[model samples]
Target: MIIDLRSDTVTKPTKGMLDAMMQAKVGDDVFSEDPTVIILEERLANMFGKDRALFFPSGTMANQTAIKLHTNPGEQVICDKYAHIYNYESGGASFNSGVSCRLLDGNQGMFTANQVLEAINPDAFYYSQTSLVEIENTTNKGGGACWNFNEILKIKEVCKSNNLGFHLDGARLWNALVAKNESTKQYGDVFDTISVCLSKGLGCPIGSVLIGDEDIMKNAIRVRKIFGGNMRQVGYLAAAGLYALDNHMERLNDDHTKAKQIGEVLSNLSYIKTVEPVETNIVIFELHEGVNEKEFVQKLQENNILIISMGSNILRMVTHLDYTNTMHEKVLEILTSLKF
Candidate 1:
């Protein structure tokens, strides 16, 4: 069987999820008349102790909306240098929000409150005013490392003292929550806006939810409309989100367990240089200097195993609902028997 380890976004809906989507009562979501979408939003909002949640078509759109809500044009966002917002979002912050990111050097994509405090620009007109601080939980580029909840609290204090808005790119926050045993309310107590992705880890076909207090989210729908994210009868997708919340959340630990298993195998391999500590579903590792990245990937492809190359001798594999124990075993076997 061909195994796809590229991302959790590749997961297809289960039969049960498909049934839910087929049975979902849908309406025009642009006018807030979709019953299923409304329930999904309200359920997520209450879970995080937030006043409201708005749905979007993608994690990037949800996150970009949060940035727009918190800052004016020309203001800057302070975030980790490895942030997905900077690396993967196609510069939506600068394109849509007119905000530049002031990136901080942090361990495994998690920075200290002191780092955020130090990165904030002064009130002087010469500098781009630091209007917001954004962070990604379970940082993707840093090998899916989860942030310390205490450090997030510390960062929030600095933002509060400086009157800066706080935002979370929680695309993989479900992984962090399961790995760290963190409660949603704890995050609600910190960030001004939180973007959580249902497409990743949760096994939803598509959708992300942006959560915030009512005042912060009041203009969100309008912004989403301007971004061309407004949808009609989108409750069909939101139904899958609701189903995943009920059935797919706790199973994430299985993906984590499997990822750590992969990391264990990589660490023992001779050609492997380093395996980034696997806390959740993503496993990132580097090859020895002389190892050919292209040949390695091509070899795996020949075996019908697929993964991603992050260039510079680095490779990434992601565990997901679709990556079964059988596929995991086959992949590990191939990895163990590969000849240089």
Candidate 2:
């Protein structure tokens, strides 16, 4: 069997999740009549203690919508240089929102409150006005690093004092919540808008939800429409989200456990250069300066094991709900036996 460790997004719906989807009562979400979708939205909103929640087909849309909702044209956003919005969202912030990003040189994908203060543009006509700040938890590029919640609170204070809108790219937030022992309402109290994904560790086939106050999110639906994110009969997918929320959250720690095991094995190997601390399910490691990443990835593929390269010499493997114990043992055995 092929062991696909590329991302948590790769998993198929579990039998239980699919059963929920098949049984879901669906309606046109564009007309706000999908009962199951409404329930999912309200459940997440109430969990976060927010006034409203809106669903999107993908996390990128939810995040871009938040950016658009918070800023006007020719504005700026502050984020880490390694943030998903800056690095992976394909310039949607600039192309769709007409805003540029002020990338802070941060640790992994996290930056300091002091960095936020420094990155703000002077209120001069020549500079793009800094209006929003976005952060990612369980930082993908940082080998699933969980942000210190205290630092997040400090950043929120900075945003409030500066009158800047704060947004969270919480795609892997369930993993963070489990790993860090943080609460949802605490985050709801801080960020102006928060986007969480259902397709990552939660194991839904598709969807992300953006949560925020009614006043701040009043225009979100309109923005979603303009962005072509409106849906009909989407409760079938929403049902999977609802099911995953109920059944899939606590099991994420198992993924984290297996990832740490992989890191431990990699660290002991003489051929491996360095491995990032495995805080969650992502294992990022680099090769010695001259080792070819493409060759290494090819070797794994040749053995029917799959992962991804995070640029030259750096590679990533993500453990998820579907990465079984048998697969884990096989991967470890293959890794231990590999040679350049």
The whole-model lDDT of each prediction reads 0.95, 0.94
Residues 264-314 of candidate 2 have per-residue lDDT tens digits of: 999988778999999999999988876788888999999999999988689
State the lDDT of candidate 1 residue by residue for 1-340, as single tens digits: 7899988899999999999999999999988899999999999999999999999999999999999999999999999899999999999999999999999999989999998888988899999999999999989999999998888889989999999999999999999999999899999988889999999899999999999999999999999999999999999999999999999999999999999999999999999999999999999999999889999999999999999999999999999999999999999999999989
Off by over 4 Å in 1: none
Pairs that clash in candidate 2: none
- lDDT of prediction 2: 0.94
Supply every candidate's count of residue pairs whose N, Cα or C atoms clash at under 3 angstroms.
0, 0
Q: How close is candidate 2 to the true structure, as a TM-score?
A: 0.99
Model 2, runs deviating above 4 Å: none
Model 2 RMSD in angstroms: 0.8
Lowest lDDT sum, 10 consecutive residues, model 1, at 113-122
Clashing pairs in 1: none
Tell me the TM-score of model 1. Answer: 0.99
